[model samples]
Target: MNNNCTEVEDPYIRYVMSQRPFGWNFTDPPVFKPYEFEKVDPFYWVSLMEDNWKVAFYAAAIYIVAIFGLQKFMENRAPFELKKPLFVWNLSLGIFSVIGFVRYVPGFMLVLSQPNGFYRSICIKDGMDLPTGYWTLLFAFSKFWELGDTFYIVLRKRRLVFIQYYHHVVTMIVVWIVGPLVEPISRWYTVLNYGVHSLMYPYFALRAIGIRVPVFIANLITFLQLSQMIIGFTVNMTSLYHQQIGNDCIRYPVSIKAFSLVYGSFILLFGKLFYDSVIKSGRRQKEKKLL
Candidate 1:
């Protein structure tokens, strides 16, 4: 991490620094001449996200009803073989996630690369008024589309676990809540999610296309999910510690608790998932072999 990052004056960093919405007067002076503020990154993203976070809650409700309704509808019917559609769906999500990861990870990296980067990255409100913000917006909206994943599960007569739906519903709402603010911790959350989906979705695409993905590879995906949950939990606790000690960087104690609870639940859910799929399944396989 460069203590004098402002001194380096990299053009890319300059551009990103110039693009923050809530005014970062980082010496270079965010000029309105050649690089007009609107041209660099639109301001409407923050407004739209902050304004419409409630939409996520409504969407989640609709998603819950639709999934259960679909499940009941499909209970008496033969499962449709929508292999190609599923393949396309997973592949599209994979590509979308990869693009988001590519575009947004660097913003957080840049945050950490700056002086006091780690703390500032955790505390500051680097609003979404940059190129990275666009992808971040898409990442949140993508949750709405992700509800379709459950539809696929229900229609296919696959078991739709509580963790799966619960995670989606809560995530959709929370991402919307924290997205516009782009809280330092939430920034990390978005990056981790993009990274995980980047790997997980492509693997799903391969399976969707009838390719024989290895069991170990599937286990690895679950492992990554568990890792994400643990990391999220740890970060929330760290943020809480900062709050307790009178850190003026952010004032989100209740939000932090909510985030912690969500991540903690995930830790339990994904841990059980890993145990059932990996550890217990491995034991069963060993027992069968011995038999």
Candidate 2:
């Protein structure tokens, strides 16, 4: 299905457009418009969620300090030992992941099915027309539930890596911030991530349940994360380029450069970590065997 607002064009283009598959709406010119009303302040939406931000930040801060402090002070804390509570946590995460994944694949296909324009699927002006916001809101709220991940580690006495812990907490904050603050690409990223997590968290859950999942299967989650980064970068880049050239005729409410940089950097960092942990470790082990 073609998912876009047909742009205003010359008479000849309009004549050709009349023969197109989907009917076109030719009332207004395809000029860029900010999401909010022209008179409304840009900060209004963000301000609505400021209270949520403060709470999330403080909670994240406390967790960070406690996790690190406990790691230093406690020597025997570890996730190696299996327990009933751990099993329950894993099962819960598995269920959540499954639900998340179910929504993601279809959502992704919808976005991918859209034609050339980056913002066409869920543009700032007419987002109501697309289903992106509904999924995004659900995905955003799910982050709050995911805060339990760190709690699981703390209870099990596992060493929470700085990156993983920080990524979790900060991402919760970021997703919440971006949800309503500005126009996001919406369901595209959320679906991809949820689908991956669907598989990933379940793997952890199975392991927690004393089911020895193959190492290769767990590695698939890492691969998915890397793929997500690549796709995310591609999407953001396309959005920025089209906006710059005015080809898409969509005006972003915020700085696409800033968004792209932060998202891109996140993918790069995570990609490096995966390589070091899995690929590099495998290579080193192989080298030792050769020696």
TM-score of 2: 0.70
Error of 2 at 194 (Å): 0.5
User: lDDT value for candidate 1?
Assistant: 0.74
Off by over 4 Å in 1: 1-42, 126-129
Q: Please provide TM-scores, in order, for all candidate models, with all chains considered together.
A: 0.82, 0.70
lDDT of 1 by residue, 1-291 (tens): 222436645553333233323443222222112223324333465555554556877888888898998898888899987899999999999998997787676667777887878776777755333545556667778888888888888888998899889999988887776555455576778888999999999998898878998899999999999999998888778777777798856635546767887898889999999999999999999999999
Q: Which ten-residue region of model 1 has the weakest summed lDDT?
A: 25-34
Candidate maximizing lDDT: 1
Say which candidate scores most in TM-score.
Answer: 1
Q: Candidate 2 on 1-291: residue-level lDDT in tens?
A: 121226533442333233322221112222233233222332343334433445667767887787677666556644446456667776776676676555345534544466733467434233222123334455766777777777667666766676677667766766665554334365556766777777877777777767898777867778888888788767767776766676643324333554576567777777887898689978998999999
